[model samples]
Target: MSALAERWRAARPKVAGLHLDSGACSRPSFAVIDAVAQHMRHEAEVGGYVAAAAAAPALDAGKSAVAALTGMTADDVIYTTGSNHSLDLLLSSWTGPRTVACVPGEYGPNLALMAANGFDVRALPADGSGRLLVDATAAMLAADPPAIVHLTALASHRGIAQPARELAETCRGLDVPLVIDAAQALGHLDCAVGADAVYSSSRKWLAGPRGVGMLAIRPALAQRLRPRLPPADWNLPMTVLQRLEHGETSLAAQVGLSVALGEYLAAGAETMRAALAAVGKLTREALADVDGWRVVEPVGEPTAITTLAPTNGADPQRVRDWLVAERGIVTTHAEVQRAPFELAAPVLRLTPHVDTSAEDLATFRDALADATEEV
Candidate 1:
């Protein structure tokens, strides 16, 4: 077993359960938790409204930190409840025709949103390895044109990294609007993609508290996006992003998210990314020789997500349940619903963070072997 990152190890206390489900939700550092608690305490001390007004500076700082995380300015940032809500706000406000261009490995919820909003999905052609082909995508854009180009920077299952920068450049040349689902890539990879807009959840990878997400819109695209919500007051005018995030919000969650982003930047984003990548590689290598398991992600891809499927008819959910109940090893299941076109069957998803140690991964491997046998 290898040692965990020193900075992260000191900041994050040990957990009772061996947490390997960071892709689903990461454990926030003590500082982030305390920030949230402090806001709530302030609310209790003063009135909720008064407390929120006082916390406005901290809330604005959080938005700025999130904008920095995505290489954008504070004015471009909009806070939402989570990734799904952010995507809904963006998609629902799209005034373009009922047509969208997306890769085959599009996030299932985004696909569902497009269908629900009366947008027809056009699958872009991909290379043999399931990556979008630039020429073919351009050709598609030229021919049966779509109203918007949607890209999931990283697949939720199998940790497949998409060619987002290249696609962004292509979309810009084609004069098309590009929106990126950056939930998994925000904290794990280099998130500064050249896209018109990017949205992500705070819980994953960033180690921020749940119930907070971020949306960054380019200035040029901001005014073009039709405002979805009406102004609360007749005299008050709001920017498109402000209208999307209008009304009351969770002040405590917003403060926590800001702290989390600050912590990530202080710890060094590239250092955390490299540490997480090593953990993913170690997990894949450990399970490479395991009898009835197959690692889905290819080597050398910079991702913290590792997906494994049972090769000998072993039920994935049964294995997951056994691991939790018997071994206190927490993991998640990636069903076909996450990415229907990319994933063939249900997979066991193991997402390790910088705090994850080699010892923890070894324990998970042993537990998984036992679960496969017992269940």
Candidate 2:
């Protein structure tokens, strides 16, 4: 293992078996766990408000870390329960026409959220694989600009990464506000694109605790949002982004997320990204000749997510369950509901992090073959 992978695996000692499900949730480091425990302990001794007050600086640092990752200022970021909540807050706060242009394969929940918010959701031009065609998208935006341009930087169901930076540039040229769902890309891929708003959960690539997410809005967009108002009697001074945040939140989770971000920075972001990409390539290559299943992504797709489809109409969930129960290998089954507009059938999603080894891939391949035979 690489030194960084070694340290990552060491910090996550509970992962006794091969773990290939970082797309769903990563293994939290000891530092993150301790931070949560320490904050909870402090809350037990003191009061919740008091413990939160003491953690203000750490929380601020966490915001700064998020800003650093997303190319925004700390003042532009706000904490939320998770990505869904973050997107809801933004959508609810919108004061303009309810129209959104996004990829056809956008996350199903996001599509539902747009519908609930009464938005006319339109599909951006993309190839058959669901990757945005940059020139075509630019032409489409210029011809009929939507109120908002939303892009999921990386998808949940597949490994094909959208051209977020290219689309961001086009949206900027057209003066259209672009919202990015970086749930699968924040720590795994570079998220420093010039989108007007970016949001993600902390648990996936950052290896933070669950129940914590963040949203960062550019100053121009932040000023335009009509977020919920505080009570008239409570004369609390707050920034526009801060006003969007709920009054009560879990300080323990915030502290854990901060420690996790700190660890990612300390480990070197570029180093981690490269390691993940390498492992993804390794996985695709190793599983190329595995029988009864085929890799869904192109061998050269620069993403840590990989998907496989059974050739013989086998249930992916059964294979996933068998792998875990019999082989101690963890993975996720991506249903068509995750991207109902694009996916034809369910797929087996494998997302290995930097800690994944070649030996792990080999083991997974052999185990998957066995699973295919049995299932």
Candidate 3:
């Protein structure tokens, strides 16, 4: 293992077996775990309000870290339950026409959320591989600009990293607000794409505790959002973006997120991205030779996610179950519901982090061969 991988493995002591499911949730580091426990203990000793007040500085640092990660100011960031809540908050608070331009492969729940909020969702121009075509998207925005443009920097069902920065630049030139769902891209890929707003969860690539996420909005766009709920007098001291945050939240999880963000920065963002991309390429190349399976994403795609479709009419769920039960390997069984417009059936998604080793990949290959033969 490299020094970085060694550090990652050391931090995650409880990661038993080969954990290739970072897309769902990563193994939280011991520092993050300890931070959560310490904060909960403090909350138990002190009142919740008092404990929160005492944690103000660390929480501020956390918000600053999020701002740094998303290319926004510290005052522009707010906490939410997760990506779903963050998107709902942004969509519900929109004061303009309920029309959103997004990629056809936008997350299924996001599509449902837009429908719930009465948004007329339209698909952005993309190539056959589902990557946004910058010039075509620019022309579409010029011809008929939607209320906002939304992009998932890295999708859940596939490993193709979207052209977020190009789209952001297009939106900027046209003065169209762009909102990005960075739930899968925050720590794994470069997230500072200059979008109007960016939101992500703590669990996936950040390796923080679950139940915490963040939204960062540009100051001008933040001023335009008109949430239906009446603002509290106490919230007036906060920035327009921060006003979206409700009073009740998990302080412990917030502290854990702070530690996790700190760890990512210490690990060097570029270094981590490079390592993950290399691992993703390795995973694709190694799995290509595995019989009875087909690698979905191209080997050159720069992402940490690799999806495999079973051949010979084999069920991916059964293979996933068999891997866990027999081989102690973890993975995700992605269904069409994950990307209703893009997928035709289910696939087995393997998302390994920096800690994944060559030995681990070989073990998975052998185990998957066995799984295909039996299941």
Candidate 4:
């Protein structure tokens, strides 16, 4: 069998086990879950807090693992509950009368942060496809130079990754810091490690437990953050993390995230990227010919996400329901006009991780074909 064909065959059996609403199944190499499971068993056998303390070293090492994964320094990594929580912490650290400029269709809470922080918020128009025109974002920043310039590595709704270099380059000359919401970008795309702060949720692509998230703060900007926890020193790896890592953290989960992150990095972004690309490609090809289905192959060097929309006689939600209820094929759907693409419409996201096989894609394709018929 060909390389991709062999991969698909290997991935087929695992598909039967999935039950999540978002067809967001990544490759199985993210085995941190198994580790978490093991840790949980140990905790049950031992005491909860004691088990956590026992694993503290591994948990601490996991922080470093996250740093290596995202290209941020170990000291900059702060473990939080999830990306939203980390982003909220980062936004809270910034205050005062500052203008925040974003390409239209920016994520919700960030705009809310701008409004809540009393900073004037402005949005530049997006391209026809609702993608943030990187040049336009740069122009907006140059013309306005707000205290903060923000862009998402990938929009949560549309699966669109705003051109990092374009947005980052535009901010280069300005005093304002650039913040990239990397939640969707972490496991799927190559992180450039340029932004002032990058946040990611462990669940999406990292395959960690949903409760944990990571924030990568540039070491240079470490002093800039208004630490949330009182008078806590951030000089140490454990100390610097206090600024954001709120809530009761799961020791085993963190270790699992660390383990999963290590496995992911070892596979190398190149191998993972190639594996996901094959899956995304198959999804695009399979859905492309179906009626009332719009399949997007992003030009910003697309990731594992394959988006689908109805062409005619089908609302996106209906198509999604059909796929889920009838075919068991999971996916994301985006309307063409939302900036960051992932945030706009209900996306039928199909992320074929390294663990997904070509046969699974074939199964999904058959389901997609059947689902497109509209009952």
Candidate 5:
């Protein structure tokens, strides 16, 4: 077997099921799980503050791992509870009257956050395919530039990878701040789009423990952001990175995320992405012959997420449950609320990871086919 395949196989024992839900949450390697336990043990023995001091290097390494993936300096990485928390910190810290431009299929929670913060949210003009029209977006920026131009590098519910790099360049030309929500793209796809800021959770493609996410901002942009609240400790560093991270955090989860990032990097980004993409394509082809099923893809090239829906009026959640209960296959049901503008009905989001094998994918297709007939 290929080295990458071998590594994936080695990691398989860590997962309890045929996990095809990397888009939602991936199974972390045993090493990552152990790291978390080890940190917790140390904290219990040495006291929380002392243990944190001892783990300073590993904690710093976690930031470096995120920086390595996103092309940012380690100092620019800010740890958060999750993607939504990171975004809330970012938006809440903005001092100016807020105005933001984004795609119609922007993440549901993000839209709500903007509305709650009283920011004027504008949907950028796009082609029928939902990719932002570069010229039109640039025109809008020139006519009345929003305080920030936000883009989700990839949507969770669909297969289209947004044109974030092009939009980033456009925003850069206009000197507008570009914030990229890479919750779905950080570890699954190439994320070095050169946006002013990028943020994502560790639970998804990174396969880290939940409740820990990282945000990276350009040093220049970081300098401009004011802290959301006054510092509780004047002795602590007051850089923009430090400003976003307030209150106590899960040190063990941070260590787990660091180890997870190491595992992903050691496997090599291109190798892992290619492996995942292959499995995703294999799944799509496998299910193509299945009746009453349609693989959803937009104008852009698809990433690792293969969104499928039944045309026979079968409920998507029911289909997901059937797969889990009868077939021992795990999948995610993408709801309309997740992508309010893009999805009219729910879809079965099958995300094949680096560890999935041909046999497993074939079984998934066959089981799905059988389930479609019965339900």
Candidate 6:
């Protein structure tokens, strides 16, 4: 085992989480939070402008660091409150000549947001495995060619890992612009989606704060994007992401984001991927005998997100509540039938981060066994 994995094992015993919404932070998140606290204390002593100015190097380094993490250029990155907002900025700026297309089973709101913004939304069908048909989606794009094509790197409702880069490449083949929402795939996959635009949340896999996220626009396409409002001085810091316009930003939160991204970078993506893979394997092994619990992802697709739920009416939320109430375990239940982000039904989402452990999964299983009995 690697040093990071060993440290993760040491940290796993601490959570004692029952509901097991372990997917979000794991352990890499701690380093980010510490950096955030340290930076905040230092900034407190200085004037706002002086503070931002003083931290400019860290901020700049942060931009480069995040760019490196995503396999993109520094200039292509734009700071936003989170992936949703980052996407809103991208969606609002659409000045396409004709169509829009998306894959089904993606994060729901993004599809509606595209339609709400007036792009002609088309849903590409998926196979029985819940994976999208990239060729089919690309065909739709080729027909009239959409203003944009989209894929969610990993579906929020279940641990379905979409073939985002595959679709992104397909879109590129058709010369259509693509946007990938990688909110859940950041730490799980080191992907270059080959999209004109991409978005991700810092909180989910990167272990950053709750509010920060990232937007990566290809340089060729970044220059073409217009915010909802007018542009501000580029050097002034993007206050708010206007579809094609610009606005003010959460300076402190952004600083925290940079810190978090740096901490993730320090660990290296390969190390993180290995840790997640290890935990996911352990989870599959631990829950092998549980009859009701259904593991979402197939063995071939590598993902840390594993879901366990009652085979019957067993309300997922009640399960979530029971786990936390009984064992202080934090997790979410999935109801794929609903959407618009917040309204999306909760699923028993279990994400093991770069620091998760076999022991953690075992303890979690024990808690689940207990939770399931009363239900």
Q: List, residue by residue over 1-375, the lDDT tens digit for candidate 6.
A: 468866654533355543245455434345555666766676678756777787777767766876776678877776777877877887776555535666556567676676677777666767875688876666666776766777777776666678877887787788778787888787677666567777887777666677777787776666655555644444445433324323366556677677767666677778777777666667667776775676656644577777665565566777778888888877777666533432233457777665556666777778777777766
The per-model lDDT (C-alpha) reads 0.83, 0.91, 0.91, 0.65, 0.83, 0.67
| Clashes in predicted model 1 | 0
Model 4 RMSD vs true structure: 3.9
Candidate 5 minimal-lDDT segment of 10 residues: 228-237
In model 6, what is the error at residue 364, expressed in angstroms? 1.6
The per-prediction tally of clashing pairs is 0, 0, 0, 20, 0, 28
* Candidate numbers sorted by lDDT from highest down: 2, 3, 1, 5, 6, 4
lDDT of 1 by residue, 1-375 (tens): 334366666677677789989899988889999999999999999989998899888888888877776778888998898888887888877766868889887888888888887888989998765678988888889876677899888778878788888888888988888888889988788777678898999899888999989899988877666654683445356678878884576878888988889888887778778887888887787778788898877866678788888899998988999988998888998889988877778989999888777788878888888999998
The 10 consecutive residues of candidate 2 with the worst lDDT sum are 230-239
Off by over 4 Å in 2: 229-237
Model 6, runs deviating above 4 Å: 8-19, 25-31, 231-247, 337-346
Writing each residue's lDDT as its tens digit, candidate 3 over 1-375 gives 899999999887866678999999999998999999999999899878899999999899999999989998888898888999999999998988999999988899999999999999999988776788889999989999999999998999999899899899889999999999999999988889899999999999889999999999998898889765555444556555656886677989998999999999899989999999988998998899789999989998989899999887779999999999998899999989998998889999999998898888999999999998898
lDDT, candidate 4, 1-375, per-residue tens: 355435433533355533222224343332565778888998999988888788877777777877766677777787887766776776777644466667677777666666676678677557855567766666666776777777777765555556776666667667578778777777677776567778887767766666777888886566666665655454445444564566577766677778767766665766665665555565566667766667755533366666665556566666667876776665554444333323444555566554555566667766766776755
Better of 3 and 4 by lDDT: 3
lDDT of 2 by residue, 41-104 (tens): 9999998999999999999999999999999999889899999999999998898999999999
Q: Is candidate 1 or candidate 4 better by TM-score?
A: 1
| Model 5 whole-model lDDT (C-alpha atoms) | 0.83
Q: List residue ranges in candidate 5 displaced over 4 A.
A: 12-14, 231-237, 298-302
Model 4 residue 184 distance off true place after TM-score fit, in angstroms: 1.2
Q: Using lDDT as the measure, which candidate wins?
A: 2
Taking all chains together, each candidate's TM-score versus the true structure is 0.95, 0.97, 0.97, 0.83, 0.94, 0.87
What is every candidate's alpha-carbon RMSD to the true fold?
A: 1.9, 1.5, 1.6, 3.9, 2.1, 3.7
Instruction: Mark the 10 consecutive residues where model 4 has the least summed lDDT.
Output: 18-27
Error of 5 at 171 (Å): 0.8
